[model samples]
Target: MRNMRLAAALALVFILVTTVFLGGCGQKLAVAPQQGGLQGLKKLKVGLVFDVGGRGDKSFNDAAYEGLEKAEKEFGDKIEIKYLEPSAGGENRERLLRLMAQDKYDLIFGVGFIFTDSIAKVAKEFPQIKFGLIDGFVPGLKAENNISCLLFREHEGSFLVGAAAAMQSKTGKIGFVGGMQSPLIEKFETGYIAGAKYINPNIGILSDYIGTASDAFKDPVKGKELTLKQIKDGADVIYHASGASGIGVLEAAASQQKFVIGVDSDQSLPAKEDQRSFVLTSMLKRVDVAVYETIRSLVTQKFQGGYQEFGVQENGVGYAENQYNKELIAANKAKLDELKEKIIMGEIKVPTSKEDLK
Candidate 1:
């Protein structure tokens, strides 16, 4: 009887263990059911492909991430948000985008102008998938129905900061550091110089381009090198249109006891303790607003495609005047507002190219 009882106890333990093990395996294999919204519509899935300087750049890429986060907050479980940062250049972007499409993402966004060609190609291949391309519009592409291009009046905002730099400079010299010498970056240079000259007819403006390649946007060491050169050349104030590379410019300013203007987003918020004090102001490019609006449109089924340009008149670009730099910009507020009015009123033509400035 004792042997029989012991045998029964061992059999029960074995049965319990097998049951628990199979239950665990079952849970692991289970998939969450597809969720729906008010009208039983499926949840929205969004995929974002960030350029080289992804979320932590504290500049352009961060702004885009903010927009995505905003959308996720608003929709909650009704949406799925995913972002991809390419390990390499062009081909990687193409692969990431293609994979997102293959996964049937309801919407996708490419964060920079660098993705223009890759997005154009992938977007055309996936005609049914909605795509948003920031900072660039592919020319001669007929995928307008499915792709939306978001562009900015970077020059207009650059002009405002340029005026501020001219007014605030103690050395009668200011400088511009651009990521590349492309036409897009040239717009920033032209407008900056023009606005500076408009403020002080005799102001000396020094300009430098980081490089001719896309990688220039990510090269801060080179940015620091160029900024030091400009400072040595007597520039007490500088503005940079370079992306992540601009961080170096700000660092150099703090080290050299000069002033630096930020680009894209309000950069003062991300600057280190010492660097924040030297950031005179920033050219506020409303990339975050554009990105959020695009996602909102997709959510509401009101998505529009084709080339869309956001400008000063649309409040798409302007100067940053937060607590970090409000006191610094106060002295130039009246004149800056007047210049802003002229640009919006069509009285002042903000040059978008070097030739236009001439």
Candidate 2:
């Protein structure tokens, strides 16, 4: 981590990447409606930096963008917005954040856990500026009072979908695919296994990860390969916490007409018509709500530093029940909600780590 920081510092000197702007309301990640001019009709100035896969991932990044879009509509001409995506390998996150600080944006947002180190470093230098971090955390970030660590109880939502997968599986076996194989994604895996076991104590679960690095989220080809392997192993239903990579999982499952669960956003909503039927349900992580509320807090002068957590109790995480998956989910909805209530009531403990799952 220290080596990366040194490299980033040097990049800011000999190889800077912070000046790439595309010209728009939110030039970095989006184009907001023009309020006459960038200087005219501005209230709060906001900036956002997307994670590696950028805006079209239709998963984590897309969910965060939804919140930014909502804030733009409600705030109207009263707010100014700008967003940026990192370099191809996501190596310039710190520089982009530092540039935003230099630009004096009122509130800056780093939209994934990958930004924890970058945001924490930058927020300290610009102590007066506020930052919102989705799915990121730092040891002393709370005390800084300039950065909001927006966290989600991802395991809670994952558990619900896991239960759904177990209940719907006819093969008595299921599978889980994760992106980047980190402790964060482990929450998805652990909760999934727990929920599946809760439904059937002896149910077999086959799991795999796209990779150990950030590229894992973008590797759809590898995602498909892993999904197919799981299916061949007798696992009928599958769930994925992968970002864009899960698109391959969805496609692979549909090829065999097996059930699959999605994460972050509703995969079925944007899925191709032919592949849409295979997506059983998605674990709604509610990244949009978190982003919108953080923005709202700033507007309402209620913004505070610390870990801002959202979970099942906060309605920040759950399972999706939409037109495509309504019938399938309805068959198991009653028990799923019962498990949800148990989670919220603290009656059933959902584990976030492999050790805890045991």
Candidate 3:
């Protein structure tokens, strides 16, 4: 009886060990690979959320999408891309965050300053998930180990446009149409005015901040009305940094037979083939470049979480070469070329803020 009892005890121990081993093996098989070595066997899922303007604006959101598309092409089986376009005042911010968390996305990116608050809250709730935020800063909010903040020196690019506008304007008067009166929008205005003055101190600037922070960039009717008034004020060239609302500014410029400067992307391309005459130039923000670089960094395990700013020094922002303007202003092209070289060479600094204006 003692021998039989000992044998049973040994048998039970063996069975328990086998069961634990098999269970552990199964769990290991279920867990996805966490590093780049298994990229071929598994895909890294990524999600993006666009702000109120959404896609088809041919500007900010579209530029970000371009980067995401590039990643899909380059990473192949290594990545899967997903996106969300929030409707006006969309409450899906938290919903999207929850979806990303539940779906086990490897990384998620949020576009626009408006989503800063949402990102902050989501980042806190999911400490294990990684995130990227564009165009805004949250102070004292400790982004988890997996979060990164990307910012652009829009003022730097805007300054160059301002200088170009002042130099190219047949009319001494120039105007600015900003979508919102927030600090971000003001950055564009401050840099532009400073750049204009740098070129010609006497240039008359007609500036108007269309609406308060919340409503400023969304009101197309106000954009058109403000732009029309600027045209009537004898401003032949106007710079618009008003998101989708800038479309109205472009239309107004076309109707008035005046030149308009575009923001974020190559707006000149969006203008009708015949209406191309109205777009003098566009400020290239290179949001696509930033997004692409960030993704590449993650793939390479070079992800640095904090703040990064892109500027002319990094070739991250500038003005598109005005192919049309070059032909029209053939005689003046040399001056523009000289100015570009000077700015690039650091001989001439382009002012991009109110402090830089003087």
Best by lDDT: 2
User: What does the lDDT read for residue 209 in candidate 3?
Assistant: 73
Error of 2 at 189 (Å): 0.4
TM, every model = 0.87, 0.87, 0.84
Model 3 segments more than 4 A misplaced: 1-40, 140-144, 328-352, 355-358
Judge candidate 3 at residue 26 and give its lDDT. Answer: 75
Q: Predictions ranked by lDDT, top down?
A: 2, 1, 3
Put down candidate 3 lDDT per residue, 1-358, tens digits, no spaces.
Answer: 9999999999999999999999998787667444333544777788888776778776788888888899889986677889997757655766776688778887888888777888888877887777888887877534336678788888778878888889889889999998767878778888788778878999999998777764455667888999999999999999998877888888899899998998898888877876678888888888888788888877776877777788877878888766665564455457656766776688876555566565
Cα lDDT tens digits for candidate 1, 13-41: 99999999999977755533233324445
Please report the TM-score between candidate 1 and the true structure: 0.87
> Model 1 Cα RMSD, Å?
9.4
Q: Would you list the clashing residue pairs of candidate 1?
A: none
Q: Which stretches of candidate 1 lie over 4 Å from their true place?
A: 1-41, 88-91, 140-144
lDDT of each: 0.88, 0.89, 0.80
Query: Candidate 2 lDDT, tens digit per residue, 1-358?
Result: 9999999898886543344432332473343344345644457888999988899998999999999999999986667788999987889999999999999899999988989999988988999999998888876655449989999999889889988988999999999999998999999999999899999999999999989988899888998999999999999999999898998999899999998899999889999999888899999999999989988988877899999899999999999988998988887999999999999899998888999887
